[model samples]
Target: MSTGSLTGRVALVTGAGRGIGREIAIGLAAEGMAVGLVGRTHGTLSDTLKECVKRGSRGVAVTADVCRPGSVREAVRLVERDLGPIDLLVNNAGQVDAAEVPVWETDPTQWWRVVETNLRGPYNLLRCVLPGMVARRSGRVLNLNSGFAVRPDGHYTAYATSKGALLQLSDNIADSLARYGVVVLDISPGAVATDMTAGMPMFRDNRTWASIPYMVAVTVDVARGRFDGLHGRFVHAERDDLAELVEQAEEIRRTDARTLRLRPYKDDDPMV
Candidate 1:
């Protein structure tokens, strides 16, 4: 890819105020993508916008609830007005209500909230933004997934279910839109050190892993078409050991199935 591969490209990232989302947005900006930052928190959005501006990328912040269609629509309009047409979308906004409640004791409202933010939020954004991408015949959609999407813990039914659905959602969209030049991917970054994980019981386990910057880097690389051939696949940071993680993802795409597990390439023990 050229040095200016992402130059002039507009990207919208939801839940971009802190942690993984913040890192993803900042990484994209550093790669020359104009960014639209979305979050419910004004202060956090300000911080993220500041980081993007510091990297010399044009950025605008939108305060909206990802669960609400009207709110997402308004945010998209504001972003288009300020940053031009969106060339990429990172559906990163989500919640974890079920992570804290037992499956039997979980309230219907909380379960729905998680499903809404993790699954429906992406659907909302895609419904609003996909037309533009399809019309242009060039765009990228990258959604965040969790390790639990494949191997769930005891009580995170809502999160795990939603993420699993998101994986299929990405695959279906990519398949339907592949001819249009738009790409979709579901990426699980492993156990990233974020506010979400800092307090989780898993963080105390010997299996605890540090967050890798490759995930954020690859997200930008995907948007810039550095890994165009990898569309419709799932990627993980552990592939960093074999080659550029994104490149490995592309090679995996050439095989029969779109789903690829990345742990085998890592140097560590399989149990680790």
Candidate 2:
């Protein structure tokens, strides 16, 4: 928190072409951090990269499918070669289920695609770039998450299952990487208006949307190392107060709040 601005930090945001990812990139750049844009589409990536440059910060866009290992590694190489070592990684790239369906009624390929993109995408990015963070003993990672991770959704089975799995991934990484000066978090941006949610019947109009500023603020805090103590926890922008959450770090740790866990089934369940 000593540094007022993210002036010298470098951030890589996947799915940086549109929606929340684009906003995060531009917001970080406005704070004076150079940004590296990654996504599958070259045109949108260029557009976002241009927007970041307009914020008085440098940026580079590297096209890559996060689900592909070779491509993800190549992205890291290109970004580091131009933007310097990435100090922060915003794993914002994600996919929505092609069609909302019950688990038994889902198309197998489409279901797997959702899981692969949402879960394996981050896994690939971490496998590629985490080693550098460990070697330097410093870095921060924020996984774009969703309330569905913890809440059961009858219709959005694939998306919910993937996010639920990702929450545990964040917890595991946070525990393993904290001693290396690396912090990891799962930040749910709430009900943001984005292409992924554009077709949802519940959001037929332009109302009941989460504030973009709220999501951006949380990202900035993570980038600035302001909430390192809340590492490995789930942060829901719609319900949790960031300031208050940070203050309750001790209690959170004690109670194991903001993480996925199993119910004891019975108070005396020793196996649990």
Candidate 3:
């Protein structure tokens, strides 16, 4: 869809206080979409809302913890009341383990906390926002996933597990909502230089970081339906050539190549 096509549409973005969420909200706003900034801190959410307004788009700042069902419900109600029915939902709020440690060594509370935020938070938002989308028979949902969702990470077990589950959630929801004209996508920004990444030990010595502009561009493309063909699949902004991906989308869908699946030991394996 073109920039003009996006005008007057509404988007609800969690974790819009900072990092990738903040950038995505601003990007969508630049395209003329009304934005609802959801975050735990009012100051940061307001900061992002200001940027959206500065871009000549309408927006509202909603301070709410995504992990809480009541808060998420209220947030959705408020955003819809203020901006109109949400045309898009961006589940970007997440958290990593406080320390990189083996599962056995990880604090149980902290592990659950990470899972609650990364997994439950999105579920909450989906539960609250999907009804309207399905009722209208038009909407898009983007989950900010990670490479860890597709791979194993011994050090950040909680983070990895939560992301993996989130990917499955996206796939299942996409299947259930397809007839309703609701699309769901899992997008990974790679290792962008964000406060979250800065706190991770793995990137301490890494000189390379994903391009923020590129990440935002890909997100905007998804928001505009450019990547709708890849719905219910994974998109990695830093590693994927989107144009090439779009070209291959049909084949990818036919082969179910980008989705998570159990690999059978052999072609004749019973699982296959």
Candidate 4:
């Protein structure tokens, strides 16, 4: 929660052009990190870059599509060239295009596209970023997961599958990379009022909507490695304030019981 917590950090945020991504980039910038904004649209990326600058820190913008390996790799190169070695990687680029359609009725191509962006994109960044972090013996990688990863319904099968796979990948990487001091975590923002959720029926009730800035705070906490003790874990934004959530995770880590493995929970499951 300190103003300079991320002062020397350089963060690369995917999907940084708009909505939650833009807010997150700005939030990190406000925290004093040099932020690299990555997005496919030049206009949106430029807008985000300016906003990030206005938010009071160094920033750069890169155009890239997460679904394409070449694009993602190029974005990473650009970030390194413009910013610095990424101290933090926020895998926030993904879409839920298949959310309203039943799995059987979903277009195969679109479903695969969703998988490529939602799952493969994170993997691509992790593969590229891990070596440097491992060699340095310090870094943070936060994979943006979703509530649907566990509580998936018929309509969200493809999107949820992608997120679920991502969560598994995060856990596996955390387990392997811990010795090297690289911490990987899966964070679900959950029901934020971003462009992606504007038209959702649930958003019709204002009381249920969460603002983007709050989720950005969660990203800030995650980037700070607050949940380090519970590496390979998932945190829900709605559960508690950032520090309290981290403390809860630390408590879970301290249990040290053989039978206390974290079972991925459904969205509707009681958090208590």
Candidate 5:
């Protein structure tokens, strides 16, 4: 993790108005990447962009909703126009409105809204950004995910379902885009202080929280393509050491670890 590893790179971070998105965008700017802060609120996005500029790098704020394809396309165009081609796209915009409710008890509209924001948001960005990256044969995408995506869960069907699908989407895109020199990563920034998690019952008063710097450092590593071998796989900022993971990169690729999949009843189960 050298200083300025992202020098000359351009990154666009969604949900950058505040919280983890804001922190990571500022962190990337501190690493010398020109950053574009995207959010629905212009004033708040501007606030984050100012913080990034304070770190001594180019930072622009764009107001756009990730769930809207046209808005996302225009946001990408704006970012590229001002900051140069995006070297990294951080898909951090997400929703958790139905997070605390059971599947059977949640409102259909609200639940689907959560799914659309969490799942469709990144797809909208990719539909607009992937073509340019493929043509240029360069780019990287980081999908903000959750461990709950695969682990057992209760009263969080919408969030878990969307994240699981997002994980699969990351793997598929990684595999399809690798030949073009692009990589896709599934990063689960552990329970940190964010608007999304500040009210969680588990962290109501827990003074000690996961370090934002750790996740930012890992993201900077991903931005630099340091763990490309772990592309399409998942990593937890608070759990996995980037250096150690890089060391074990080959084994991870060989075994396809950190991915979501289905397992049969037994290893000896015969295939059709």
Candidate 6:
């Protein structure tokens, strides 16, 4: 599918109120897709919808917490009622640790809150949205993942662990939906300068930040089916050479190169 092919398709974007989510919603609208902007804040979601409308696309702003299954179900109902059956779903709502502290020092409640927002939120969305997609046998789901998922971070354990689980979630769903003609992908925006990232100490002195437009462009490309061959793999907007990755898609599939896995102790290891 090309950008033109996305015209009139419906998309539901969680966290569409601000940052990368807002930009992605606008990008899809610019391509002529009707978008459903889902977020907790009505004001921000409304602003996003206005931006979408300015691009000559239809949109609806629905305030709902993605962490709650019931709320997600209602949100999905409203979006589909206003736009139509969702062709694309973007799970982008997430949170980070309150402070850079070791797991032992982190508040258990706070830790679980972050985990629920980042992991359970996407699971709720998938539960509410996938049924229609599976029935139709045509849709795409994009889980906003992170590099931390593959690397260890002592201070951001909750964030890292949640993202890692989300990666596995995408992989599992992709395998299940493969024969159904549905696509699932895990995309990492690569430390973009957002309100969320501004609070991170690691990025405070960093000179380079990921490009919002670049990430949005990559998202639009994925929505256009440019990277469907890489379904279930992790795509990092900042680090990846997308075209080259597409060229190597078959090789990637054969090797299971991008999905999460455990490394064997040696060549003779049974796990291998």
TM-score list, all predictions:
0.86, 0.96, 0.97, 0.88, 0.95, 0.97
In model 5, where do residues sit more than 4 Å from their true spots?
270-272
Q: Write the per-residue lDDT of candidate 1 for residues 112-188, one digit (tens) a residue.
A: 88899999999989998999999999888988887777676667788888988888777767778998999887777
Lowest-lDDT window of 10 residues in candidate 5?
263-272
Model 5 agreement with the true structure over 66-107: per-residue lDDT tens digits? 999999999999999998998999999988753466678898
lDDT of 6 by residue, 1-272 (tens): 22555797999999999999999999999999999999999999999999999988999999999999999999999999999999999999999998899999999999999999999999999999999999999999988899999999998999999999999888887788988899999989998989999779878888889999998888888788898999899988799999999999999999999999989999999987
Whole-model lDDT, model 3: 0.92
Select the stronger candidate by TM-score from 2 and 5.
2
Whole-model lDDT, model 2? 0.89
Q: Please report the TM-score between candidate 5 and the true structure.
A: 0.95
Listed per candidate, the RMSD to the true structure in angstroms reads: 6.1, 1.9, 1.4, 4.8, 1.8, 1.6
Candidate 3 per-residue lDDT over residues 52-77, each given as its tens digit: 99888999999999889999999999
The regions of model 2 sitting more than 4 angstroms off are: 1-4
User: What lDDT does each candidate get?
Assistant: 0.82, 0.89, 0.92, 0.80, 0.87, 0.92
- Tens digit of per-residue lDDT, candidate 4, span 27-107: 999899999998889999999889878767898898888877788788888888888899999999888754477788888
What lDDT does model 4 reach? 0.80
Clashes of each: 0, 0, 0, 0, 0, 0
